[model samples]
Target chain A: MSLLRLRRASLSYPAGGGSVEVLRDVDLTIRRGEFVTVLGRSGAGKTSLLNLAAGFVAPSSGAVEVDGRPVTGPGADRAVVFQDDALLPWLDASENVAFPLRLKGAGRAERLERAAALLRLVGLEGHERKNLWELSGGQRQRLGIARAIAAEPEFLLMDEPLGALDAMTRDRMQELLLKVWRASGAGALLITHSVEEALFLGTRVVVMEPRPGRIGLDEGLDFSARFLEGVPARALKAEPAFIAARERLIAAIHAEEAA
Target chain B: MTVSATNLPERAASRFPSGGRPALPAAFLRRLPVFAALFTLTAVFGLWWIASARGWAPPVFLPSPDRVWKAAQIAADTGYASATLGQHAAASLGRVMAALLVTLLIAVPAGFVLALSPVGRGLLDPLIEFIRPLPPLAYLPLVIIWFGIGEGSKILVISVAMFAPIAISTAFGVGSASESQVRAARSFGASRFQTLRHVLLPAALPSIISGVRIALGAGWTTLVASELVAASRGLGYMIQSAAQFLVTDMVIVGILAISLFAFGFEILFRLIERFWLPWSRRR
Candidate 1:
């Protein structure tokens, strides 16, 4: 079953005297264990689509459903990794991961134990007590991912989760994300402007266009599975097939610009 | 070869031929501001002593440091204006603290409400602005007439003085809570009250604490002024009566006592800010 589905969803905001359409007739879906990436230029409403899936915003028309149930508002079933890695500053690393469990009324010992396990899964085993400011940017993002998965949500919605990181850190995070996604088996819809990242991490990639944004291309690829089968990221990127796919995705985006 | 020759002299000069003095130890550098402050304080006192000794101002008016010291000892041991120095100081402190307690109890929750809800802010913003700028003393006449020159009136005056700063800062703090933090909380399925408790409250705490500190100072100032007009027991009362009687020594003692109390409270607030909100200090 599809973990999340957006059916002909449209979103618009009131601007000056009339409405400015951000997304129009946007249909997307993420089945269980599938890794989906949405690629677009700025103002292409990729984020608006993600917000609709997360139920952070409502569509002006059509439906956003999770597991056949319509999404009316945000719920624990869907978790978001925000662009800025918005971990609560007052809470230390472990406490931040444990926050959602606490919201669900889990006991102290249980939540702490679960949080420590999630932190360890994200490779932050011993840095449990470090404050948010003390953690480097990449570490903060890892903590955000840990917190997102701590609730065991069926779907993870990430909006430019690696956009703030340096190249080396982003590369390492991309590998880590594949490992976590494969292990958790939770469907993911990641939005980004990076073609390399979209190709490397996604089992399926969707390209979007702006000015009443709509999906431009939807393609299925096996790169993420090939990486899982022990094809190293560096080696895969240098392959002629990988290069060709990357070019095709870029061209699809440019086609939207020309249109 | 020419470039090498020029570079050798530049390197040698940078390494060993400097004319500047050696750098001071970190400990001494850190204490430099303290030393400067002490020097300035001592110079002011020395000037006062020299002027008094040279009869720059008559002893009856200025009263030498020795006379003030003697007055302090006398007030501490016997009494000042029918009450000992401790009693007078305590009276003023008690009124300020009482008013502060009332202000905290009322203003903090009110501030949070105003911050969290636009309707609450709309209702309260005008009233807060109107009351904030009017001097606590401006309401003195109305307070005295209503509550009758007693402890009630004086406490009410100080409480009125304190309420504005605490409420304003809390509202500002709540308003300033980062959007990302609030969104993160909501995404985790936290309700509005839970978001306030876990996110907004902690984010706004540093501002709220600083506001309370400002309100304390304002409340103290208003307490003294209120006591001057009505009360018979506080330091302000002692100083006003002593001035009328031309007892310059007693007046000096009252002023010094008030200064000492204010200084002590400032230290206490600083320590609380350091200990309770260490994360706020990091930024």
Candidate 2:
């Protein structure tokens, strides 16, 4: 199986006098079809980690590689969904989804057909012709996911893409994200502040501690797999084992914060 | 436009005024400003008519409304200086449009260069700043001396006046593209060219259209001034000639023609914007 590996990666930025290290010697590896969630507090450099994987930022040390090949910069192999959705306002919904295909030089008709299919898959059926401004926050985030998968990327890197949604919408989107990840067959690296979300969505939840950001906990869970195996989201969330895992992750993040 | 239910029934009834009497037409209330504009125009024209008819001002200085109207009819029919009013209007419009096209072609790319590249901005920034404040007329003599009294020189002078507004606005629009927007495109492996075309260009379009409107305004003024110097078949030239001969009515007719054409262009631009960038205003 293909894998994305960030081996002892470090990132820093210039500050007054000396440089400030935002992420230091963080080692992470994601296997194909795996869902990896990076949970963190405000200053945890969780976004920085996602950026590193997406090749938007270079590591100050070590490497980010795909299948042992060094990742140079953002390429077609990785697609990112941003927190704000970032759907191009100028294009209609389908056209926005087709944008990555367009960049890959896909023909017009093929691009349209693929975009229509993807939008339908993302539960935006009949919204193909609508302007992006007409979409609700949740719908736009769904479109963002559709666009990310349109590239048929090996990795889907998302940075709190559902952060702006209401509680109800966020719950629905979490399930939708699980379905998309399975359908796309891409390794997922998602960053979020919600501990329950990390637990529910991720096959492996890696909690990052802030202030010289580093991964404080890396634990594997089968909740996402269980959800796929006919377990309803509500039932799974209310399970005693699920609660224990959620509480443990929360405690771990809080302890890291206090320390 | 929905009428949501109100809590206070008494206040709602009072607002409508008992016996189920209807309120004023919504259209009338909406069109109040338009009616006010018409009234203002009528009042201004009424004052001008009375002033000229009562000889409150010299006829040569302010011709009567009828005299100006007659002059307009004559200019349209019999022509002025071997060219009819239509021809003069067309000539002026053609010059401005040509200048606008040339300005857009150059300025948009220049704007991207200015915004995207430090070296390019360093080189072009001071030059744009220098060109922006000075009026086209300031360089008209220079252009005439260098390029002579050709149509090219006229178009060149007008285009220069049109440049800064468009270029600066384009740069501003490009800058307004959010970081996530560009990064999303880049994540799809969009090349530099693709990013600019699919991402930055559309992002910049609304501002570019507004800049074109401002550039057109600047170009119109420059066209008039340039024609005042060395043009034979434009509204400005007709106005200049009519003024020299003390034909105040013809001059007024010329001025009205220019105003009408400019207003028409503004409406045309609005329609174009609505057609192409429909989401711009909605967003």
Candidate 3:
């Protein structure tokens, strides 16, 4: 069975008088350990799709399932890293990262040890004591990623985690995310407005449309050259093949908007 | 608009250190003029004390500092004619704490319910609004009727005084918890109770602590009114009895002691707040 599935999912929110549809009959599936990137413009329901998978919002119709089990609500098996860091303001870096495990009643020592490892994974080794406010924007976002992955869930859902970061930080985060995903081998569904990011990280990229949001196109990515060795993500971004793929995805998004 | 550093005169520092230190002592030394004024006032008081010893002012009207100090010692020795200052202070502290505890136990949960449940807020908010504006002193007669002229009456009076401030502050705090924080907690598979414990309460802490500070001040003021009715052993009772006997020095001592207690409590609360919420100290 596919590790996760969304069958004809549609989400709607109450508008001025009638409900405004955000997603419409969106069907997607991923096998175990696959990386799927969802690409679209702002308000394209890419986030809504991720939110459905995260169980932040219930779909109006159809179903969201994880590993053949219905995703009736958020569960431990699926962990989400929101676009905004959403780190609890009162907690310092270590506590925030250890929160999910703390909820599951892990011993304090084990939780801290695991959280420290993940913090080191995200290059935040010495920032365990710094309060959320004291962190730079990029550091806070990295903490958000660390927190999400701390549980080492079967599936990871990221909603444009690096959108708010500067170009340098965002690029750095992309490489870090790929490295973490490679090491953990967790199935990841990433949602992003950045086409270049989708092309780089996703094993399969699903394009989405706006208004009544729906999936428009689906394409597979080839990371064949670096399949054995770690892919240098920045150098790949400047390559002709990667740029051509990015242009194609950008064109697809704009075409849907124009239509 | 460019400013030239050359146009400004440079001042020499007594001891300058590079980097690391924040110059906190320099900030303190900047307030020397205010400290000097206070020192001058103390010197003037000493001059008056010497003049009073030489009969510069009537002894009956203006008791010499030495005489007042001697009387204070005598009062201490006699245990304030019945109860010692220690006894009075204990009674006052006990009553205030008891009242505050009862007030918080009822008010905080009530505030949370009122903030979260629309039905509860609607049903209770109007009644709370109605009762709140009525001053704590105005409840004295009712409390006396209900609890009689005893410890119960005094506690009821202080609790009533503190209840409104605590409730209002708690409700405001809970009502104003950041929406995003609640949303974030909920998205993490947390149920409603978990959200309340993990997100709402912690977020509301700063406001609730401020409310406690304000409520403590109100409770202290209510102690005066509470004792005025039928109390025999407190700072208020001491002051009132001294006033009747025309012992202004004793009255002043009582007043000073009460003020001192209030000031001490405020400092204690501020220290606790700093320890608990260091994030708020900068702002």
Candidate 4:
């Protein structure tokens, strides 16, 4: 069954006197344990689509559903990892990770224990007391992911989660992301402009087109499964099949741009 | 890549003979501001002493520092106007404290409301603007008429002086809370109250603290002004009464006491800011 479903969702914003459509007739589904990657250009409304799924923004037409119910507003059931890694500066790393549990009325010891475990999962052990400014960018993003999953949400909606990282850090983060996704057992819908990342991490990839943004292509692949099956990411990416798949995604994106 | 001169290791210093002996003086030079401030204070004291000793100004107008000290001693032992210097200072401090506490309790919450709600802001913005610009002394007459030469009027005057800065800065703090932080909290299903407590309040805290500091200074100033106009006790009343009788030494003692107390409060607030909100402190 689909963990999150968007049925012909459309969004428009009031631009000057008239309305400007940002997303048009977009339909997608994220099933349990699936890693879905969305590829789009800058103005393709990828964020708008993610916002619709997360219920941060309501659709102007059609509906966004999660577990067979319509999404009205943001809920703990669908946690989002933002590109900016919005950890509160006033909070230390551990406190930031424990915030969701704190909101849920968990006891101090319980929440702290859970936050410590989550921090360890994100490979930030012994850095629990570090202030937000003390954390490196990649560590902050990892903290963001840890915070997202601390609530044990059914779906993780990520918007360009690794967009700000350097090449080496981005590669490491992608591997870590897959590991976290498998451990949490939650469906993910991540939006990115990187074709390599989309091919590397996603079980299913969707391409979005701009100028009244809509889904351009949807394809299923097995690279993530192969990577899970003891194939290292470097070896997997260097394989002919992986290269062909990456080319196909890139070609699709470029073709959509031309269209 | 070319090696830069900055990256090169330093050679042995020929001028020092034993590495560098200037380290001590360099360290002292780094503390130049402290010495400069001390020197400036000493010079001012020397000038005051010279002026009085040379009879540059009559004793009725500008009494010597020893005369002021003698007046302080006399006030401490015999009491001035039936109360000691301590009583006057305590009264002034009490009024400022009460007014500050009351202002903080009311204004901080009202500030949050005004910042969070458009309707609250629209309704209160004009009234706050109107009252904020009017000097605290301008309202002293009306306050005295309403509450009469009691503690009520004095505290009210100080409270009025403090309210605007505290409220406005708090509102600004809330308004300037990071949009991304609030959005992240909301995405985690944080309710309005939860957002306020967990995100908005902490984010606004630094600004709120700064507001309190500003309000303290304003409140202290207003307290003195109000006391000068109408009061049996307080440093301002003591100074005003002494000036009326041409007791220059007593007036200088009262003025110095007020300055000392204000300086002490400023240091106390700085210490509180450092200890309580360490994260807000700049590196």
Which pairs, if any, clash in model 4? none
The candidate with the higher lDDT, 2 or 3, is: 2
Instruction: Give the Cα error of residue A33 in candidate 1, in Å.
Output: 2.0
What CAPRI-style quality would you assign to candidate 4?
medium
The candidate that wins on lDDT is 2
Please state the error at residue B55 of candidate 1 in Å: 2.7
Listed in order, the DockQ scores are: 0.60, 0.80, 0.39, 0.56
Which pairs of residues clash in candidate 2, taking residues 3 or more apart in a chain or in different chains? Answer: none
DockQ rank order: 2, 1, 4, 3
Cα lDDT tens digits, model 2, B136-225, are 879999999999999999999999999999999899888868889989999999988898999899989888888887888798888888
Judged by DockQ cut-offs, is candidate 3 incorrect, acceptable, medium or high? acceptable
Query: Considering just chain B, what TM-score does every model have?
Result: 0.87, 0.87, 0.77, 0.86
What tens-digit string does per-residue lDDT give for candidate 4 at B1-283? 1121222222222333545554556677546556776898999999999999999999998899999899999997887966899998888998988999999998998899889999999988998898898898788888888889778888988998899888988998887677767877887889989999988888788778778878887987887788866588988888888888989899999989988987897778767767877777532
Model 1 error, position A167 (Å): 0.5
> Residue B249 in model 3: shift from native, Å?
3.1
Off by over 4 Å in 2: B1-25
Global lDDT of each model?
0.86, 0.89, 0.78, 0.87
Candidate 4, residues A1-259, lDDT tens digits: the string is 5579999999999999999999999999999799999997889999999989988899999899987799989888888998999888777898899888988888988988999999999999999899888888999999999999997888899999999999999999999999999999999999998999999999999999887999999999788888888799999999998898888878888886566
Tens-digit lDDT string for candidate 1 (A91-163):
7898899999888888989988998899889999999889888989999999999898986778888999999
